[model samples]
Target: MYAVFKRELMGLLNSLMAYITIGVFLLATGLLLWFFPDTSILEYGYAELTGFFSLAPFLFMFLIPAITMRSFAEERREGTYVLLAIRPVTDWQIILAKYFACLVLVVFALIPTLIYYYTIYQLGLPQGNIDGGAVTGSYIGLLLLGSAFVAVGIFTSSLSKNQVVAFALSVFICFIAYSGFDAVSQLFVLSYFETVFLSLSVNEHYQSISRGVLDTRDLIYFITFVALFLIATKAVTGGRKW
Candidate 1:
Protein backbone atom coordinates (compact mmCIF):
# COMPACT_ATOMS: atom_id res chain seq x y z
CA MET A 1 0.00 0.00 0.00
CA TYR A 2 2.78 2.38 0.93
CA ALA A 3 4.64 1.59 -2.28
CA VAL A 4 1.54 2.22 -4.39
CA PHE A 5 0.77 5.34 -2.35
CA LYS A 6 4.28 6.72 -2.87
CA ARG A 7 4.27 5.82 -6.54
CA GLU A 8 0.88 7.38 -7.12
CA LEU A 9 1.84 10.55 -5.23
CA MET A 10 5.07 10.87 -7.18
CA GLY A 11 3.28 10.18 -10.45
CA LEU A 12 0.88 13.03 -9.75
CA LEU A 13 3.71 15.37 -8.76
CA ASN A 14 5.60 14.44 -11.91
CA SER A 15 2.65 15.12 -14.20
CA LEU A 16 2.35 18.55 -15.82
CA MET A 17 -1.44 18.23 -15.77
CA ALA A 18 -1.35 17.95 -11.97
CA TYR A 19 0.54 21.23 -11.71
CA ILE A 20 -1.80 22.92 -14.18
CA THR A 21 -4.85 21.75 -12.30
CA ILE A 22 -3.49 23.05 -9.01
CA GLY A 23 -2.37 26.28 -10.61
CA VAL A 24 -5.76 26.95 -12.13
CA PHE A 25 -7.47 26.28 -8.81
CA LEU A 26 -5.17 28.70 -6.97
CA LEU A 27 -5.56 31.30 -9.66
CA ALA A 28 -9.33 31.12 -9.64
CA THR A 29 -9.57 31.34 -5.86
CA GLY A 30 -7.07 34.18 -5.75
CA LEU A 31 -9.05 36.12 -8.31
CA LEU A 32 -12.32 35.56 -6.52
CA LEU A 33 -10.92 36.48 -3.12
CA TRP A 34 -8.97 39.60 -4.09
CA PHE A 35 -9.59 40.85 -7.61
CA PHE A 36 -13.25 40.10 -8.30
CA PRO A 37 -15.37 43.03 -7.25
CA ASP A 38 -18.35 40.86 -6.39
CA THR A 39 -16.77 38.16 -4.27
CA SER A 40 -13.76 40.17 -3.13
CA ILE A 41 -13.00 40.43 0.56
CA LEU A 42 -12.42 44.16 0.13
CA GLU A 43 -16.02 44.59 -1.01
CA TYR A 44 -17.34 42.62 1.97
CA GLY A 45 -15.72 44.98 4.48
CA TYR A 46 -15.27 42.10 6.89
CA ALA A 47 -12.37 40.05 8.19
CA GLU A 48 -14.32 36.83 7.82
CA LEU A 49 -13.44 34.51 4.93
CA THR A 50 -17.07 33.57 4.42
CA GLY A 51 -16.99 34.40 0.73
CA PHE A 52 -14.00 32.16 0.15
CA PHE A 53 -15.41 29.30 2.18
CA SER A 54 -18.74 29.60 0.40
CA LEU A 55 -17.24 29.57 -3.07
CA ALA A 56 -14.62 26.85 -2.60
CA PRO A 57 -16.93 23.84 -2.79
CA PHE A 58 -18.23 24.92 -6.17
CA LEU A 59 -14.65 25.26 -7.37
CA PHE A 60 -13.91 21.85 -5.95
CA MET A 61 -16.73 20.31 -7.97
CA PHE A 62 -14.66 20.92 -11.08
CA LEU A 63 -11.16 20.76 -9.58
CA ILE A 64 -11.37 17.35 -7.96
CA PRO A 65 -12.89 15.70 -11.03
CA ALA A 66 -10.09 17.10 -13.17
CA ILE A 67 -7.52 15.61 -10.78
CA THR A 68 -9.13 12.20 -10.51
CA MET A 69 -10.44 11.77 -14.06
CA ARG A 70 -7.26 10.02 -15.12
CA SER A 71 -6.78 7.97 -12.00
CA PHE A 72 -8.36 4.88 -13.53
CA ALA A 73 -9.60 6.13 -16.88
CA GLU A 74 -6.17 6.82 -18.34
CA GLU A 75 -4.78 3.59 -16.97
CA ARG A 76 -7.60 1.60 -18.48
CA ARG A 77 -7.37 3.45 -21.76
CA GLU A 78 -3.61 2.90 -21.96
CA GLY A 79 -3.86 -0.74 -20.88
CA THR A 80 -2.03 -0.08 -17.61
CA TYR A 81 -4.96 -0.87 -15.35
CA VAL A 82 -4.53 -4.58 -15.87
CA LEU A 83 -1.00 -4.42 -14.55
CA LEU A 84 -2.11 -2.43 -11.53
CA ALA A 85 -4.97 -4.80 -10.75
CA ILE A 86 -2.79 -7.91 -10.79
CA ARG A 87 -0.32 -6.45 -8.29
CA PRO A 88 0.27 -8.11 -4.92
CA VAL A 89 -1.56 -5.38 -3.07
CA THR A 90 -5.25 -5.64 -2.23
CA ASP A 91 -7.80 -3.75 -4.30
CA TRP A 92 -8.58 -1.48 -1.37
CA GLN A 93 -4.93 -0.44 -1.19
CA ILE A 94 -4.89 0.58 -4.84
CA ILE A 95 -8.16 2.48 -4.50
CA LEU A 96 -6.98 4.21 -1.35
CA ALA A 97 -3.54 4.94 -2.78
CA LYS A 98 -5.03 6.58 -5.85
CA TYR A 99 -7.63 8.33 -3.72
CA PHE A 100 -5.05 9.77 -1.33
CA ALA A 101 -2.74 10.83 -4.15
CA CYS A 102 -5.54 12.82 -5.78
CA LEU A 103 -6.60 14.17 -2.38
CA VAL A 104 -3.06 15.36 -1.59
CA LEU A 105 -3.05 17.25 -4.86
CA VAL A 106 -6.28 18.91 -3.78
CA VAL A 107 -4.59 19.85 -0.49
CA PHE A 108 -1.70 21.38 -2.42
CA ALA A 109 -4.23 23.62 -4.15
CA LEU A 110 -5.84 24.52 -0.82
CA ILE A 111 -2.65 25.31 1.14
CA PRO A 112 -1.99 28.50 -0.83
CA THR A 113 -5.38 29.84 0.21
CA LEU A 114 -3.99 30.27 3.70
CA ILE A 115 -2.36 33.41 2.39
CA TYR A 116 -5.87 34.80 1.95
CA TYR A 117 -6.57 34.03 5.57
CA TYR A 118 -3.40 35.76 6.72
CA THR A 119 -4.12 38.77 4.52
CA ILE A 120 -7.56 39.03 6.04
CA TYR A 121 -6.11 38.57 9.50
CA GLN A 122 -3.84 41.55 8.97
CA LEU A 123 -6.59 43.54 7.30
CA GLY A 124 -8.76 43.20 10.40
CA LEU A 125 -9.39 46.47 12.24
CA PRO A 126 -7.81 45.08 15.41
CA GLN A 127 -5.16 43.18 13.36
CA GLY A 128 -5.71 39.46 13.92
CA ASN A 129 -9.32 40.06 14.90
CA ILE A 130 -10.53 37.45 12.41
CA ASP A 131 -12.46 34.46 13.63
CA GLY A 132 -9.70 31.90 13.87
CA GLY A 133 -12.00 29.15 15.10
CA ALA A 134 -14.36 29.48 12.15
CA VAL A 135 -11.45 29.57 9.73
CA THR A 136 -10.03 26.39 11.25
CA GLY A 137 -13.39 24.70 11.09
CA SER A 138 -13.96 25.77 7.47
CA TYR A 139 -10.56 24.41 6.50
CA ILE A 140 -11.43 21.14 8.15
CA GLY A 141 -14.76 21.04 6.38
CA LEU A 142 -13.08 21.71 3.05
CA LEU A 143 -10.65 18.85 3.60
CA LEU A 144 -13.45 16.43 4.35
CA LEU A 145 -15.44 17.75 1.42
CA GLY A 146 -12.45 17.26 -0.86
CA SER A 147 -11.97 13.72 0.36
CA ALA A 148 -15.54 12.83 -0.50
CA PHE A 149 -15.16 14.37 -3.97
CA VAL A 150 -11.99 12.33 -4.56
CA ALA A 151 -13.88 9.17 -3.72
CA VAL A 152 -16.64 10.18 -6.08
CA GLY A 153 -14.12 10.94 -8.81
CA ILE A 154 -12.29 7.65 -8.39
CA PHE A 155 -15.55 5.77 -8.59
CA THR A 156 -16.57 7.58 -11.75
CA SER A 157 -13.14 6.99 -13.26
CA SER A 158 -13.53 3.30 -12.71
CA LEU A 159 -16.74 3.28 -14.75
CA SER A 160 -15.19 4.51 -17.99
CA LYS A 161 -11.98 4.27 -19.98
CA ASN A 162 -12.52 7.79 -21.35
CA GLN A 163 -11.04 10.56 -19.27
CA VAL A 164 -13.59 13.10 -20.48
CA VAL A 165 -16.45 10.85 -19.52
CA ALA A 166 -14.93 10.26 -16.10
CA PHE A 167 -14.46 13.98 -15.60
CA ALA A 168 -18.00 14.85 -16.61
CA LEU A 169 -19.56 12.11 -14.49
CA SER A 170 -17.45 13.05 -11.50
CA VAL A 171 -18.35 16.70 -11.77
CA PHE A 172 -22.05 15.94 -12.12
CA ILE A 173 -22.02 13.65 -9.11
CA CYS A 174 -20.03 16.10 -7.02
CA PHE A 175 -22.47 18.89 -7.77
CA ILE A 176 -25.43 16.71 -6.89
CA ALA A 177 -23.83 15.40 -3.72
CA TYR A 178 -23.00 18.89 -2.55
CA SER A 179 -26.35 20.62 -3.07
CA GLY A 180 -28.84 18.44 -4.94
CA PHE A 181 -30.40 17.34 -1.71
CA ASP A 182 -30.98 20.87 -0.57
CA ALA A 183 -32.75 21.56 -3.82
CA VAL A 184 -34.89 18.50 -3.36
CA SER A 185 -35.76 19.52 0.18
CA GLN A 186 -37.13 22.78 -1.11
CA LEU A 187 -39.88 21.06 -3.08
CA PHE A 188 -43.33 21.39 -1.59
CA VAL A 189 -44.06 17.75 -2.33
CA LEU A 190 -40.93 16.71 -0.40
CA SER A 191 -41.67 18.92 2.56
CA TYR A 192 -42.43 15.93 4.75
CA PHE A 193 -38.99 14.57 3.97
CA GLU A 194 -37.20 17.89 4.04
CA THR A 195 -35.16 17.09 7.10
CA VAL A 196 -34.03 13.78 5.65
CA PHE A 197 -33.00 15.36 2.36
CA LEU A 198 -31.11 18.25 3.94
CA SER A 199 -29.31 15.88 6.28
CA LEU A 200 -28.05 13.96 3.27
CA SER A 201 -26.62 17.04 1.59
CA VAL A 202 -22.91 17.76 2.09
CA ASN A 203 -23.65 21.47 2.45
CA GLU A 204 -25.78 20.93 5.52
CA HIS A 205 -23.03 19.20 7.47
CA TYR A 206 -20.34 21.42 6.04
CA GLN A 207 -22.23 24.54 7.06
CA SER A 208 -22.56 23.12 10.55
CA ILE A 209 -18.82 22.59 10.92
CA SER A 210 -17.99 25.89 9.21
CA ARG A 211 -19.67 27.52 12.19
CA GLY A 212 -16.81 26.23 14.36
CA VAL A 213 -18.83 23.48 15.99
CA LEU A 214 -17.75 19.98 14.99
CA ASP A 215 -20.37 17.28 15.19
CA THR A 216 -19.75 13.57 15.20
CA ARG A 217 -22.71 13.04 12.88
CA ASP A 218 -21.13 15.18 10.16
CA LEU A 219 -17.84 13.31 10.52
CA ILE A 220 -19.61 10.00 10.29
CA TYR A 221 -21.59 11.12 7.25
CA PHE A 222 -18.44 12.10 5.40
CA ILE A 223 -16.75 8.84 6.39
CA THR A 224 -19.69 6.83 5.15
CA PHE A 225 -19.90 8.85 1.97
CA VAL A 226 -16.24 8.23 1.17
CA ALA A 227 -16.42 4.57 2.11
CA LEU A 228 -19.44 3.94 -0.10
CA PHE A 229 -17.76 5.23 -3.25
CA LEU A 230 -14.47 3.50 -2.52
CA ILE A 231 -16.24 0.25 -1.87
CA ALA A 232 -18.12 0.76 -5.12
CA THR A 233 -14.83 1.29 -6.94
CA LYS A 234 -13.44 -1.87 -5.41
CA ALA A 235 -16.48 -3.75 -6.62
CA VAL A 236 -15.99 -2.41 -10.11
CA THR A 237 -12.30 -3.34 -10.18
CA GLY A 238 -12.77 -6.69 -8.57
CA GLY A 239 -15.31 -7.74 -11.15
CA ARG A 240 -13.11 -6.85 -14.08
CA LYS A 241 -11.01 -9.59 -15.76
CA TRP A 242 -7.79 -7.55 -15.37
Candidate 2:
Protein backbone atom coordinates (compact mmCIF):
# COMPACT_ATOMS: atom_id res chain seq x y z
CA MET A 1 0.00 0.00 0.00
CA TYR A 2 2.79 2.40 0.84
CA ALA A 3 4.44 1.62 -2.44
CA VAL A 4 1.22 2.22 -4.26
CA PHE A 5 0.69 5.46 -2.42
CA LYS A 6 4.21 6.69 -3.05
CA ARG A 7 4.16 5.73 -6.70
CA GLU A 8 0.79 7.30 -7.31
CA LEU A 9 1.77 10.51 -5.59
CA MET A 10 5.11 10.65 -7.32
CA GLY A 11 3.54 9.94 -10.65
CA LEU A 12 1.24 12.92 -10.26
CA LEU A 13 3.90 15.23 -8.88
CA ASN A 14 6.30 14.40 -11.70
CA SER A 15 3.71 14.81 -14.41
CA LEU A 16 2.43 17.96 -16.09
CA MET A 17 -1.15 16.97 -15.36
CA ALA A 18 -0.71 17.60 -11.65
CA TYR A 19 0.75 21.04 -12.21
CA ILE A 20 -1.88 21.88 -14.81
CA THR A 21 -4.76 20.82 -12.60
CA ILE A 22 -3.46 22.70 -9.62
CA GLY A 23 -2.70 25.74 -11.74
CA VAL A 24 -6.13 25.72 -13.32
CA PHE A 25 -7.89 25.38 -9.97
CA LEU A 26 -5.97 28.25 -8.43
CA LEU A 27 -6.04 30.47 -11.49
CA ALA A 28 -9.73 29.96 -12.06
CA THR A 29 -10.65 30.55 -8.44
CA GLY A 30 -8.37 33.55 -8.22
CA LEU A 31 -9.94 35.06 -11.29
CA LEU A 32 -13.41 34.64 -9.89
CA LEU A 33 -12.54 35.92 -6.44
CA TRP A 34 -10.07 38.71 -7.24
CA PHE A 35 -10.41 39.55 -10.91
CA PHE A 36 -13.96 39.11 -12.17
CA PRO A 37 -15.67 42.44 -11.61
CA ASP A 38 -18.98 41.14 -10.33
CA THR A 39 -17.49 38.57 -7.99
CA SER A 40 -14.28 40.31 -7.04
CA ILE A 41 -13.46 41.29 -3.50
CA LEU A 42 -12.65 44.80 -4.65
CA GLU A 43 -16.15 45.13 -5.95
CA TYR A 44 -17.74 43.60 -2.86
CA GLY A 45 -15.97 46.13 -0.62
CA TYR A 46 -15.61 43.51 2.08
CA ALA A 47 -12.76 41.53 3.60
CA GLU A 48 -14.66 38.28 3.76
CA LEU A 49 -13.70 35.45 1.40
CA THR A 50 -17.29 34.26 1.04
CA GLY A 51 -17.08 34.26 -2.71
CA PHE A 52 -14.12 31.88 -2.71
CA PHE A 53 -15.80 29.31 -0.51
CA SER A 54 -18.98 29.61 -2.53
CA LEU A 55 -17.18 29.14 -5.84
CA ALA A 56 -14.69 26.43 -4.92
CA PRO A 57 -17.22 23.61 -4.76
CA PHE A 58 -18.17 24.04 -8.39
CA LEU A 59 -14.55 24.04 -9.52
CA PHE A 60 -13.66 20.98 -7.44
CA MET A 61 -16.46 19.02 -9.10
CA PHE A 62 -14.41 18.92 -12.29
CA LEU A 63 -10.85 19.30 -10.93
CA ILE A 64 -11.04 16.21 -8.73
CA PRO A 65 -12.32 13.90 -11.44
CA ALA A 66 -9.64 15.09 -13.83
CA ILE A 67 -6.97 14.27 -11.27
CA THR A 68 -8.34 10.83 -10.37
CA MET A 69 -9.52 9.74 -13.81
CA ARG A 70 -6.30 7.87 -14.44
CA SER A 71 -5.87 6.17 -11.06
CA PHE A 72 -7.28 2.80 -12.05
CA ALA A 73 -8.52 3.46 -15.55
CA GLU A 74 -5.08 4.01 -17.00
CA GLU A 75 -3.71 1.08 -15.07
CA ARG A 76 -6.28 -1.29 -16.49
CA ARG A 77 -6.01 0.21 -19.94
CA GLU A 78 -2.29 -0.27 -19.90
CA GLY A 79 -2.53 -3.70 -18.29
CA THR A 80 -0.87 -2.55 -15.04
CA TYR A 81 -3.82 -3.23 -12.79
CA VAL A 82 -3.31 -6.99 -13.11
CA LEU A 83 0.29 -6.50 -12.08
CA LEU A 84 -0.87 -4.53 -9.05
CA ALA A 85 -3.19 -7.37 -8.01
CA ILE A 86 -0.41 -9.91 -8.01
CA ARG A 87 1.44 -7.86 -5.42
CA PRO A 88 0.85 -8.31 -1.67
CA VAL A 89 -1.40 -5.27 -1.26
CA THR A 90 -4.92 -5.98 -0.08
CA ASP A 91 -7.88 -4.71 -2.06
CA TRP A 92 -8.92 -2.00 0.39
CA GLN A 93 -5.36 -0.85 0.85
CA ILE A 94 -4.92 -0.50 -2.86
CA ILE A 95 -8.09 1.51 -3.23
CA LEU A 96 -7.19 3.61 -0.21
CA ALA A 97 -3.69 4.31 -1.46
CA LYS A 98 -5.03 5.63 -4.72
CA TYR A 99 -7.71 7.56 -2.90
CA PHE A 100 -5.22 9.20 -0.55
CA ALA A 101 -2.83 9.95 -3.38
CA CYS A 102 -5.49 11.80 -5.31
CA LEU A 103 -6.68 13.54 -2.15
CA VAL A 104 -3.20 14.74 -1.30
CA LEU A 105 -2.95 16.37 -4.68
CA VAL A 106 -6.25 18.05 -4.02
CA VAL A 107 -4.87 19.33 -0.76
CA PHE A 108 -1.77 20.57 -2.49
CA ALA A 109 -3.90 22.48 -4.91
CA LEU A 110 -5.84 24.07 -2.05
CA ILE A 111 -2.77 25.09 -0.09
CA PRO A 112 -1.91 27.90 -2.47
CA THR A 113 -5.32 29.46 -1.96
CA LEU A 114 -4.34 30.31 1.59
CA ILE A 115 -2.82 33.43 0.09
CA TYR A 116 -6.35 34.66 -0.47
CA TYR A 117 -7.09 34.31 3.21
CA TYR A 118 -3.97 36.20 4.17
CA THR A 119 -4.74 38.98 1.75
CA ILE A 120 -8.26 39.27 3.09
CA TYR A 121 -6.98 39.26 6.64
CA GLN A 122 -4.78 42.25 5.91
CA LEU A 123 -7.31 44.04 3.76
CA GLY A 124 -10.08 43.98 6.38
CA LEU A 125 -11.19 47.39 7.62
CA PRO A 126 -9.71 46.88 11.08
CA GLN A 127 -7.01 44.47 9.94
CA GLY A 128 -7.79 40.81 10.68
CA ASN A 129 -11.45 41.72 10.93
CA ILE A 130 -12.62 38.85 8.79
CA ASP A 131 -14.91 36.14 10.07
CA GLY A 132 -12.18 33.82 11.27
CA GLY A 133 -14.40 31.11 12.68
CA ALA A 134 -16.60 30.92 9.61
CA VAL A 135 -13.61 30.88 7.29
CA THR A 136 -11.99 28.05 9.23
CA GLY A 137 -15.19 26.05 9.25
CA SER A 138 -15.70 26.60 5.54
CA TYR A 139 -12.18 25.43 4.77
CA ILE A 140 -12.73 22.29 6.80
CA GLY A 141 -16.03 21.65 5.08
CA LEU A 142 -14.44 22.13 1.67
CA LEU A 143 -11.67 19.69 2.47
CA LEU A 144 -14.14 17.09 3.66
CA LEU A 145 -16.24 17.65 0.54
CA GLY A 146 -13.15 17.23 -1.62
CA SER A 147 -12.27 14.00 0.18
CA ALA A 148 -15.71 12.58 -0.51
CA PHE A 149 -15.22 13.57 -4.13
CA VAL A 150 -11.91 11.73 -4.28
CA ALA A 151 -13.68 8.55 -3.27
CA VAL A 152 -16.30 9.07 -5.94
CA GLY A 153 -13.62 9.64 -8.56
CA ILE A 154 -11.72 6.52 -7.55
CA PHE A 155 -14.87 4.44 -7.65
CA THR A 156 -15.67 5.61 -11.16
CA SER A 157 -12.09 5.11 -12.29
CA SER A 158 -12.20 1.54 -11.08
CA LEU A 159 -15.35 0.91 -13.09
CA SER A 160 -13.70 1.15 -16.50
CA LYS A 161 -10.46 1.37 -18.46
CA ASN A 162 -11.43 4.43 -20.47
CA GLN A 163 -10.19 7.63 -18.88
CA VAL A 164 -12.74 9.87 -20.61
CA VAL A 165 -15.61 7.60 -19.58
CA ALA A 166 -14.26 7.44 -16.05
CA PHE A 167 -13.99 11.22 -15.89
CA ALA A 168 -17.53 11.73 -17.14
CA LEU A 169 -19.02 9.13 -14.83
CA SER A 170 -17.15 10.48 -11.82
CA VAL A 171 -18.27 14.04 -12.51
CA PHE A 172 -21.87 12.91 -12.96
CA ILE A 173 -21.81 10.92 -9.73
CA CYS A 174 -20.20 13.74 -7.81
CA PHE A 175 -22.77 16.23 -9.12
CA ILE A 176 -25.67 14.01 -8.07
CA ALA A 177 -24.18 13.27 -4.70
CA TYR A 178 -23.32 16.89 -4.10
CA SER A 179 -26.52 18.53 -5.32
CA GLY A 180 -28.96 16.10 -6.88
CA PHE A 181 -30.80 15.44 -3.61
CA ASP A 182 -31.62 19.12 -3.21
CA ALA A 183 -32.71 19.31 -6.84
CA VAL A 184 -34.97 16.35 -6.35
CA SER A 185 -36.49 17.80 -3.20
CA GLN A 186 -37.78 20.79 -5.14
CA LEU A 187 -39.89 18.54 -7.40
CA PHE A 188 -42.12 17.45 -4.53
CA VAL A 189 -44.04 19.71 -2.20
CA LEU A 190 -43.94 17.35 0.78
CA SER A 191 -41.79 19.06 3.39
CA TYR A 192 -41.13 15.98 5.50
CA PHE A 193 -39.62 13.77 2.83
CA GLU A 194 -38.03 16.73 1.08
CA THR A 195 -36.00 17.47 4.15
CA VAL A 196 -35.02 13.83 4.36
CA PHE A 197 -33.74 13.79 0.81
CA LEU A 198 -31.87 17.05 1.28
CA SER A 199 -30.23 15.58 4.35
CA LEU A 200 -28.96 12.77 2.17
CA SER A 201 -27.22 15.18 -0.20
CA VAL A 202 -23.62 16.32 0.25
CA ASN A 203 -24.46 20.01 -0.20
CA GLU A 204 -26.75 20.00 2.78
CA HIS A 205 -24.06 18.55 5.01
CA TYR A 206 -21.35 20.75 3.54
CA GLN A 207 -23.40 23.89 4.00
CA SER A 208 -24.23 22.93 7.55
CA ILE A 209 -20.60 22.42 8.41
CA SER A 210 -19.59 25.61 6.61
CA ARG A 211 -21.70 27.74 8.92
CA GLY A 212 -19.13 27.50 11.76
CA VAL A 213 -21.20 24.77 13.40
CA LEU A 214 -19.79 21.27 13.47
CA ASP A 215 -22.71 18.94 13.55
CA THR A 216 -21.96 15.30 14.28
CA ARG A 217 -24.58 14.19 11.78
CA ASP A 218 -23.04 16.30 9.01
CA LEU A 219 -19.57 14.87 9.60
CA ILE A 220 -21.05 11.39 9.68
CA TYR A 221 -22.74 11.99 6.36
CA PHE A 222 -19.45 12.73 4.63
CA ILE A 223 -17.58 9.87 6.28
CA THR A 224 -20.32 7.37 5.56
CA PHE A 225 -20.57 8.24 1.87
CA VAL A 226 -16.81 8.36 1.42
CA ALA A 227 -16.56 4.92 2.99
CA LEU A 228 -19.39 3.67 0.83
CA PHE A 229 -17.66 4.78 -2.36
CA LEU A 230 -14.27 3.42 -1.30
CA ILE A 231 -15.81 0.07 -0.41
CA ALA A 232 -17.62 0.01 -3.72
CA THR A 233 -14.34 0.67 -5.52
CA LYS A 234 -12.68 -2.15 -3.64
CA ALA A 235 -15.43 -4.53 -4.65
CA VAL A 236 -15.19 -3.51 -8.27
CA THR A 237 -11.43 -4.03 -8.40
CA GLY A 238 -11.52 -7.29 -6.46
CA GLY A 239 -13.98 -8.89 -8.85
CA ARG A 240 -12.25 -7.65 -11.97
CA LYS A 241 -8.66 -8.12 -10.82
CA TRP A 242 -7.66 -5.80 -13.59
Model 2 error, position 140 (Å): 0.4
lDDT of each: 0.92, 0.91
Q: Write the per-residue lDDT of candidate 1 for residues 151-222, one digit (tens) a residue.
A: 999999999999999999999999898989989989845466998898899999999999998999999999
lDDT of 1 at 156: 98
Collision pairs in model 1: none
List the RMSD of every prediction in angstroms: 1.2, 1.0
Record all residue pairs in model 2 with backbone atoms less than 3 Å apart, i.e. clashing: none
Candidate 2: where are CA atoms >4 Å away? none
| Superposition error at 204 for model 1 (Å) | 0.7
User: What local lDDT does model 1 show for residue 110?
Assistant: 90
Error of 2 at 36 (Å): 0.8
Per residue, candidate 2 scores C-alpha lDDT tens digits across 1-242 of 89999999998889787789889999999899888999999999998888998889989999999999999999999998888889888998888899999999999998899999999999988999899899999999999999999999999999999999999999999999888999998986677888888889899999988899999998889999999999899788888884
For every model in order, what is the number of clashing pairs? 0, 0
